[model samples]
Target: MINKMEAKHLDFYYKDTQALFNINLPVEKNAVTALIGPSGCGKSTFLRTLNRMNDVIEKTKVVGEVLMDNKNIYDPDVDPVELRKKVGMVFQQPNPFPISIFDNIAYGPRIHGIKNKQKLQELVESSLKSAALWDEVKDRLHDSALGLSGGQQQRLVIARVLAVEPEMILMDEPASALDPISTSKLEELVRELKNNYTIVIVTHNMQQAARISDYTSFFLNGKLIEYDQTNIIFTAPREKQTEDYITGRFG
Candidate 1:
């Protein structure tokens, strides 16, 4: 499998404090890769670097190479806005737009200059269907998105991301805020979506990581401790820190 994204000697700092250290990993194309570690271990920081999301934070400095599809994302010529369009993100919380569900999914295409009603409708329908939310919300496309349940809202967010037709999807604890059933549904959606889009998820739930990820990276104290196949990382990690964390002995 070809690598969809790669990090080389990644280091991040916020003012005087360093958050990541010499991190290196490869994200496979059309696969689910999970970043698992204790809180504040820089997993989310690393995920944000993929699409330069950290650029918005004040006093944040990044020194490393984040390569997506053979192009260095941090290069001076790289357009952050275009990068973001190619690499979409889904936050931990389900933050649906305060508008009609159809409009929420149509927003991205509209921004990209697609204004035809039929085309927008097709994009909305396909995106929602891809995110496994079409049947539930098809009749209510014009309903307020805020009225949906948490899980539905989350799926709506996923559909919105999909409508943009991103090549890669970054999920920062996509299901962490949801209940078990919702989480399960999200996991199923991730599994289904991986056949088309490369997925990188930052999650603290080891069980969820083990359940859904094809690859897993373990981080500790702003450093990458181990990265390998998910099953091997869970069953018999080469690093003691990884073993301890996965076995629940320690973070």
Candidate 2:
């Protein structure tokens, strides 16, 4: 499998406190990789480093390399905005714009200088369809996005990210706010999306990680303990800490 992204010796600090230590991970192209750990374990922090999302915080510093396409994304000359366009994020909660459904999907494309009405319309339709949300919202394209159910809203948020045609999709507990049915649907969507987009998901649900991920990484106390195929990690992890965590002994 081809590695589309890789992190080497990644360490992160917030103000004077260190949050992540010497982390290395290789993300396979067109595959879903799950980051599993307890809260405050640096999964989200490491996820943000891929697209420089952590740069938004004050007095933060990242040491080491996050590379995509063999180029370090942390290089000073790299444009984080453009990198973010290539690598989009889906948050834990659905945060659709308080605008029409069509507008929500078209928002990214519109900002990227796609103004032609027909083109925007086509983009909206394709993105929504790709996110598996088109049929449900096709008729209500002009309706406020806030009116959609939580599940629909989350899918719509994914569609919004899709409009930009990203190469990588980073999700942070994307289904944590949804119902069981919604979570199931989202898992299906993740399976489908991996055919075209490399996905890295940070999830608290062990069953979820097992259900949808091709690879799983176990983190504890801000360090990566083990990373392997989902089957290996869950069935026969090499490390006792990993096995313990997977078996519900301790996190």
Candidate 3:
């Protein structure tokens, strides 16, 4: 299988506390790989490591490698800013900038120096369409993004990411805050996004993982307990710990 990114013997530390241990995982191109685990199981920590998001934390150190296109992203020469552009992130909360919806999608491209109004307009339209929110917000592009619903806000955040033309999207419980209908819509957007961008998501919702991910990695206490196809992991996990967690016996 072709991999877009891989973590090789990756370990992370926050000061003296090691939050991740020897995480070896592969992210396939244009596919969804779900990181599933209970709270505090290092899923989010591992997600942040992919694009060096952990670097922002004071006294945090990453050892070993997180390779994107076979180059170690943690290398001293790699620009974190550029890396972030290629590996966009979405948090659990919908954090619109309180600006116009059009401006929110235009923010990243603007920072990267796209000055033509026509180009920015096209990008904003396409990005919104990519996130499947264009029809709802087409006439309201000039409206404040905060005026949108939670689901719309989250999709706006995603459109903002897409405007930068990222190769991979990392989502940390991207639907956790929404109601069932909103969550379903977000999930459908995710399934569609994988057709264009590699997706790595960390979710506490096991059923969500089962529904949307092509592959799954089960993490526990800072270690990967199992990694396999979603169907296999869900139906026939090789590890007993993985089975227990999926079966809801213990976290």
Candidate 2: RMSD over Cα atoms? 0.7
Query: Model 2, 166: alpha-carbon shift in Å?
Result: 0.4
Tens digits of per-residue lDDT for model 2, 1-251: 89999999999999999999999999999999999988888999999999999999999999999999899998989999999999999999999999999999889998999999999999999999999999998998999999999999999999999999999999999999999999999999999999999999999999999999999999888899999999999899999999888888983
User: Across residues 86-113, which tens digit of lDDT does each residue of candidate 3 receive?
Assistant: 9999999999997999999999999999
At residue 60, what lDDT does model 3 achieve? 96
Cα shift from native, residue 103, model 2 (Å): 0.5
Sorting all predicted structures by TM-score, with the top scorer first, yields 3, 2, 1
Q: Could you tell me every candidate's TM-score relative to the true structure?
A: 0.99, 0.99, 0.99
**Model 3: runs farther than 4 Å from truth?**
none
TM-score of 2: 0.99
Candidate 2 — which pairs collide?
none
lDDT of 1 by residue, 178-244 (tens): 9999999999999999999999999989899999999999989999999999999988899998888
What residue pairs clash in candidate 1, if any at all? none
The Cα error of candidate 1 at residue 64, in Å, is 1.6
